[model samples]
Target: MSRVLIVDDAAFMRMMIKDILEKNGFEVVGEASNGFKAVEIYKNEKPDVVTMDITMPDMDGIEAVKAIREFDSNAKIIMCSAMGQQTMVMDAIRAGAKDFIVKPFQAERVLEAIRKAIG
Candidate 1:
């Protein structure tokens, strides 16, 4: 099973992702509410994939992606974006995110992105 780290400002969003991932047989290694914590968790847990939220308080997903990529070039990050954040998504991709899923998330899409990212 792929180990996943979920990052979002909302606890509910993190809970939702955890539900979807665990149901799909993905192991949730860690979770973080902001980009700063996300980076710290990435280093500590070293999850195979990360589902990162775009607009966060400490640091945005794009900056977190860059930080993780810097720490581990092979880091696989999947941005979790809201509907209107197309530009931010693009920036995340450029920052080395492997893929992305939009919110409110579909379990299937989330699983697909994780599969593709791990591949």
Candidate 2:
């Protein structure tokens, strides 16, 4: 089972992800509301995967991904992006996110990205 860190500004989104990951046999190790906390949690939890939101209040996911990658070159990340965020998604990938899932999430697609990211 993989330990995962979930970073989203929305409380509901975090809960949804935690529920989905838990039901799918992945551990939700930590949750963060913004990119700054995301990086802090990443360091503390050292989860196997991180599901990061692109448009966050502080720092944003792209910068957070880069910061995480700086500390851990092989850190596995899956970006959670809204529709029509192709440019940000691409930036996230370039910043070292392994894959991305578009919202509102489908269980299958989210799982696929998770599997692909950690596999």
In model 1, the Cα lDDT at residue 76 comes to: 95
In lDDT terms, how accurate is model 2? 0.94
The residue pairs that clash in candidate 2, if any, are none
Task: Assess candidate 1 and give its lDDT.
Answer: 0.95
lDDT to native, each model: 0.95, 0.94
CA-only RMSD, every prediction: 0.6, 0.6
Where is model 2 more than 4 Å wrong at Cα? Answer: none
Return the TM-score for each candidate structure. Answer: 0.98, 0.98
Q: Runs in model 1 with CA error above 4 Å? A: none
Model 1, position 47: C-alpha lDDT score: 94
